[model samples]
Structures are given as C-alpha cells and as structure tokens.
Target: MLGPLQVRGKDGPLRVPPGRQEVILAALLLEANRVVGTNYLVDLIWEDNPPETARTQVQICVSRLRKLLAGADSTVSISTRPPGYVLHVDTGDVDSLLFTGLVAMARRQRDEGETEKAVALLKSAVALWQGDSLTGLVSGPLANKAHQLDEERLSAVELRMQLELELGRHDRLVGELQLLTHENPLRERLRGQLMCALYWSGRQAEALEAFRTGRRILDQELG
Candidate 1:
C-alpha cells in the first residue's frame, strides 16, 4: 500500500508475481475488506479499451493472487462476493491506513495543544513511507489515489515542521528542511519553511538565497 507492493508471509516477504496480479492485488488492498466491483477493475486495468476476455483474465489474476497468498499470513486474504472481491485484514496491517490513523491522531493532539505529542505521532506517520506512494503502479487507475497519498505525506511533514518551529527547535529543523526543500523545490510552502528555518538558525544569507532561488525557478519555469 506504500512504496512497493509486498506481501508478508510467516517466514518473511512473499513475492507477488508481476503483471495483472500485482495490479489486482494493489486494487484489492486499496479497498481492503470492501467489495471492488469486477467492472470497475476491468476499466481500471484496461483503461477504456478492454477486450471481451478482460473479466476472465481478471478472474485468472485473482486466482493467481489467491494461490500466492496461500503461503502468506492468515490475517490477509481475498474473498469473492458476486460482482467483486474483498481483501480481509486489520486496518493496522496496511501501512497507508496506519499512516492515516496516526496522522489523524496527531491532528487531534495538535488541536488540543499537545504539540510535542503531535510531532511524535507525525514522525511515526512519516516513517511509514518507504518512498513515493505506489511508485510502480501509479501509471494506471491508482494515479489519483497515489497523488493524494503523496499530498497527505507532504501536509503531515509541513505540519510537523510548523509545530517544531513553534517549539523553538529551528536548529534541529534546518537540516531536515534542507533535504525536503531540495527534493521538492517546486513546492513553495516547503521552500518558505526552509527559509524560515534557515533564518531562525542564524543563517540569514542562506535564508535570503532560498527565497531568491524560489523566485528564480518560478519566473523561469512557471512564467
């Protein structure tokens, strides 16, 4: 659900066969324990041009997934219910769902003036990401969802930075902000944050340069 799609068995990581099986499993995992219609999957995988055998092909993919999962931990599974299928697992079993839960809890903590606790929870949430969301599967139906997840991660990061800055931890934040701003140069909010961190840490020249760099990039690329 986060980064690459992986299944854990009693031993260790289970290898999911590549191709449609990977996509089907990803779709089912996205809607764990909820029915995902067969037609929707056909449209998602084939993308507006599906052969007549699409449904059968989907069924075959599901069968292969089931066989692969047979060796996986019992807590995860797939079940057919008419027009669709369901992937059964605890909410905590899914990294993305767990990340969402942590972020929500952190937001509640932040709203209640528990800024330290909020930052801690946000750290946990951010640590769940191994890399960009759905890195290999984003070209298909999961594109929008993957983008949304990435946005959620970014928001969590920014919120944590704000809280830490407010707590007067700007010294510790400068290095992190540098890396984030480097990775996401086009994100103006992150750039602003990096500038603030640099200024607060007494690197006033660097702060001004950060601002200048952003202005230059916006003028040259977006103008």
Candidate 2:
C-alpha cells in the first residue's frame, strides 16, 4: 500500500478494492495519524446502522488491510482500545501529513527571515504531492478530507512562492508562478504573485497585463 489510503504501483491511483474492506481503509486514511474510534468507524461505514455482524466484519477488514500493507514499507497498524480501534500510521510516512509539516516549518522559517531555507522546505513539500489527494478513492467524507488537504497543500505553495518573491527571487520563480496563474486563474493571490514576479523581473508590461487579466477573470467569474 502506498499509504493507508493510497495504494501504489497501480496503473493509476490505487483503486479501493470494491467492498467493505475498502470503506474501512478509506475511513482510517481520512483519519490518518489519529485514533479513530471503532464506534465512529462503524457509523461511517454503515451510516449509523450496522449489520448484526458489523463488528466482526470490521475486524476482518482491518486484518486484511494489515496483510495487504505488509509487502510495502508497512507503517500502518491496528490499535485496539477499550472504546474502539485506532489505525495508527506514522505521520512521516503519509505524504499529506509530511507536506503539512514541511509547509508549517517553511512558514516558520520564512517568518524568521530564512528565505533560502524556507524555499528549500517549501519545494520539498510541494514535490511530495503525487496528485490530487485520494484521487481514485470513492467520494464521501474521506474525499472531503482529501480535498481539504489538497487546499492546504496549494496554500503552502502560494505562501512559499510569495516568500521567494519577497526575497527578490522573482526572476527564479517567474516561470512557476506563471504556470500556476494559468492553472489557477481564479486564485487572486496567485495572480497577484504572478504580477509581482513579472514586475520585479523587469516585465512591467506583463505585470500590467496580468493584473488586467485577473480583474477580467474576477469580474466574469464572480459577477
């Protein structure tokens, strides 16, 4: 397993094998690095109503997932407590958590005016993203969590780029910021960064053009 939720070596994002086992694994990943109550897991899988054999089924799923993960650098484990079971996966092994930690560190470094170090940390954080979080996972609470994580990841990228620009690394960042602007046309902050980078790169006309484009986009998209 690439992670608790992300299975690797597949043609694409790992498909959660169709069944209750997949559901259980997905839930654990959504709550990755946290202690998820068994009660909560049951509720999530069965929507507050479980089969007479629900507890047994959950156990089966957990057991199977453990075996599935054994072949890889298995860090995921099932922890049993009085109230419920917790899937304990290390945060460093999970890309999203790693990204979050890196971004947080980068922000702290940036705030401390360690621009070069911040840039390095931020780049590593962004590089951890394989693609959209839980790309092939079934949509539900788990998907929402993935989306939220993705948002945080993107926000970190923007923050890092902003810091780089502030450090007069705009010339180095112009290409990346320009690409991000094209992909995230509705993100005003990204557009602003693109403008800043362009202006500092001695492309005053491009900076003005970017501002106009952003304004037009906001007007058209929001108005």
Candidate 3:
C-alpha cells in the first residue's frame, strides 16, 4: 500500500509501490509545485472510462500517499484544492529539485562576483547526487526530470570549476576532475575543465595532452 512507499531513500530503494497508488503519486509529483484536478487525476490513473468507484479510489490513494509522506517528513504536503489536490513539496528537500535551485543560485552569485559563495553552493548541490538521477525510479516524466536536473547539476559544477581556477584551486580539483572526465569521457565541458585545471596547476604539457585526448574522443564518438 502507499503507507509502505518511500520517496527515494530512507528504506530499501525508495519507490512508490507498483499499482494504482503509485500511478496517482507519479501524476501528482509530475506536476509538483502545482495543483492537479480531480478529473485530471482520474484521467491520468484510469485513462478513459473509469469504474463507478473511480472517485473513491482516487481519494483513497491520495490519502494513503499523504500518510506515507507524513511518516517520512511532516512538511511533505498534499493539500486540497477546489478541483483537486496540490503537492507542496519544497524544491530544496528533493535532490533533483534542490540541485536545480543550487545551480541557479550559484550562477547568480557567480555573476555578482561572489566566487566563494558560488563554489560552496555548487559543491553542496553536486554532492547531493550519489549516483544517476532518480536512482531507483523507472522511466517516466519523473525520469526525464531527473535527467534534466543532472545536466543542470553538471553545468553548475563546470561553472564552479571555472571560478575555482580563477581563484587558483586547480591543485585541489585536478585529481577529482581527472577522474570525473575519465568517467564522463563524452562530456567535452568536463574534459575542458580538467584541461584548464591542469593548465592552471602549471602542467602545460599535460593540459595539452588532456585536450588532445578529449578531442580524439569527441571525433571518434561524435564524428
């Protein structure tokens, strides 16, 4: 039932259990930060021509999910609206949502010449992602959201590294950046960051080597 469902972690690979309840929660979270109407929820979960108990079923699912979230975090809320329900989860509480906020804030701070704050914020955001976005969730709108959030998070890291180089933190970032670039060989920006870090670390030849390798990988993979 929804009572045993977990968000992303805090139990055995947090996930909304498989069934109509999971379907309902997915629909709500898809539009997290906004309201979803009763009719629309019915349509999403049951598609065309729901049974006579459709309304009752939706109410039950929402109520159960609300209870599960309550057990996890009291602030995680699903509130009533005239037409339906609103999921009012803070963007900061979820890794993907928080990652987006941090990236945006870091960019603004960087633009304002607040490098230290920008680096700190960006690092915190990137650190929240232990692995791929939505580690346990299957493909869906939520999966797409997780992927986009991850891309934004990576961009934030690149931006922070640029500022770090400006602040001469290359020696500190070089090893980690090397591993990052190796893991994401297809990411030219990450490779570029590693190159720049090497260059700023006073390893001009190695920096050039990094650039060459990046270019070769790009040519081979992307042509």
Please give the range of 10 consecutive residues that has the lowest summed lDDT in model 2: 1-10
Ranked candidates (TM-score, high to low) = 1, 2, 3
Task: Compose the digit string of candidate 3's lDDT tens values, residues 96-189.
Answer: 5666678788889988989999999988878876666544543354456556666776677778878888898889999989988988899887
Over 4 Å off, model 1: none
Per-model TM-score versus the true fold = 0.96, 0.82, 0.75
Provide the lDDT at 90 for model 1.
Answer: 86
Tens-digit per-residue lDDT, 1-223, candidate 2: 2223565422444444666677677677656756677766677677656799888887787777777666454556766665666667767666766777888898898889899999899889888776777655553666667778778877988888888787888888889988988888998899999998999889999999999999999899998
**Number of the predicted model whose TM-score against the real structure is largest:** 1
lDDT-better candidate, 1 vs 2: 1
Off by over 4 Å in 3: 1-30, 37-60, 70-73, 80-83, 90-97
lDDT of each: 0.87, 0.75, 0.74
Candidates 1 and 2 compared: the better one by TM-score is 1
